[model samples]
Target: MASSSMLLSLFFTILLFFFLSPTLCANSQGNALHAMRSRLSDPNNIMQSWDPTLVNPCTWFHVTCDSNNNVLRLDLGNSNISGSLGPELGDLKHLQYLELYGNNLRGKIPDELGNLESLIGMDLYNNEFKGKIPESFGKLKSIRFLRLNDNKLTGSIPRELANLSNLKVIDVSNNDLCGTIPVDGPFANFHMESFKNNRLNGPELKGLVPYDFGC
Candidate 1:
């Protein structure tokens, strides 16, 4: 009879863990947003509603979450924010739209952002970001719109971007990007205006020349 009582207690503990573990896991999404809030310098206080003590980040302004409370979008565009992005932003695995344009953000775009497999539109234009676009961005299979224009970025556009069949619009203009632009897949439809003001050697020549022709 004592052993039966112990078994009942153990069964209840297991049941309680299953019931509470989801809330704890969802709270981590809030934690990820709070981590991001702590990193950026929000001068306009646009993120004033991002209270970390909340059960989840669904209540935070500029942050969108799904029905299950998974983070979906972050609309922090033109908010006069400064500082660079960090890897913590990658924890929002369900994120789809990341709009961070027209800010004072600088430094290399974090490679961890490529881990956002659900990303659809990544609008990071009109910032002071520098360095090569992360090659890991090739992993963003769900991406549709990629606008990285008007930055200080250099180096040949990564050829891996050519694999995104779902890509519809890509604007790398007004930067220092060099080498041949990928003319394969959806890139074949993008006009020269999408690639102007860069050191690009023009489109790829298939078998005649290499993709990294200029730089």
Candidate 2:
């Protein structure tokens, strides 16, 4: 009788854990957003709904959540919120769109953002960001548009980005990037204007002066 009771208890415990997992994940997503707000300077007070006391961020403004309360997008573009991006952003595993373009945000682009496997579009253009593009961005299998133009970024473009088969728009113009432009995969369909004004010498030459030509 005791053995049967113990097995029943274990089963209920496992079931309870599974039942509460979604809420727990939602709480984590909310925490991640709160952390992000804490790092940025929101002079407009537009993020008033980002109270950490909330159980989840589903009801928060500028944030969109799915039916299961998972974060899907961050619509903070052109909000003029300055300050560096936080690594906490990576915690939004279900995030799809990251729109923070045309801001005064400065500092290195967080490598942690590459962890957003569900990411479809990422726009960080016209910011003051610097440093090399994170090579881990190649892991975004669902990515379509990657606009990082008009920043202070330098170094060679990651060849791994060319591996994204779902890529539709790839604009790295008006930056300080170098190396020969990739001519393979989705990069082959991109416009030259996409790579214009960068230090990139030319398209990839199979057996010539190497891929990092001018860098």
Candidate 3:
């Protein structure tokens, strides 16, 4: 009986270790998160609450994690974060929601953001970002909401963006964007509000209907 119990104990120990290995690997991924943190110049120190010494990013305010302890959301809206997007953000392979609206973030959206295959929602509106939307954003197949409105971005809307098969909402209004607006796929159903106040010229766009954009 003693020998039999010993064998069972060993089996259970092995099972526990196997189940915990993935968690260990994810926890050690702190280096990647730290790299992302180091690149941005947080002028207001709002992110000072994100202490690496904490048990996990899950515990950090504004950070959310999934069942596997992988980062799922990072909402830093209205935080006044300034600077360019660092390539290290690509390391967050499981990120699903990223909200950085109402900030002073400048520069173009990073092409590396396409690496986040699991992303579903992205909001970077009301900022000072410039440059064209990266062609690589077409790869965000799982994205459902993408809002980049009320910015200073300039350039033609990329036809490649129509590749988001699951996109339901996309707001690119109040920018300096021009050229033919992509119509077809999910984009065909969106109202004029989605592309309002732009220099877009296309039969696909009917222009913004009369509506008071009251403050």
Best by lDDT: 2
lDDT of 2 by residue, 1-215 (tens): 99999999999999999988888999999998898888899898879889888878999999999989999999989997999988999999999999999999999999999999999999999999999999989999999999999999999999888799999999899999998888778988998999999899888875554569667
Candidate 1 local Cα displacement, residue 116, angstroms? 0.5
TM-score, per-candidate, Cα-based:
0.92, 0.95, 0.80
lDDT of 1 by residue, 1-215 (tens): 99999999999999999988667766987887788788889978999999988788888899888777888999999999998888888888899999999998999999999999999999999999999999999999999999999999999988889889899999999999998888888888999999999999888887665566566
For candidate 3, give the lDDT: 0.81
lDDT, ranked from best to worst: 2, 1, 3
What candidate 3 gets wrong by more than 4 Å, as runs, is 1-20, 204-215
RMSD, candidate 2, Å:
1.4
What TM-score does candidate 2 get on C-alpha atoms?
Answer: 0.95
Better of 2 and 3 by lDDT: 2
Candidate 3, residues 54-172, lDDT tens digits: the string is 65677667778887788888889998777767677777888999898998888888898888899999999999899988888888989999999999888877777877889999999
Clashes of 1: 0
* Candidate number with greatest TM-score: 2
Location of the lowest summed lDDT over 10 successive residues in candidate 2: 205-214
**Candidate 1: what lDDT?**
0.90
Off by over 4 Å in 1: 1-14, 209-214
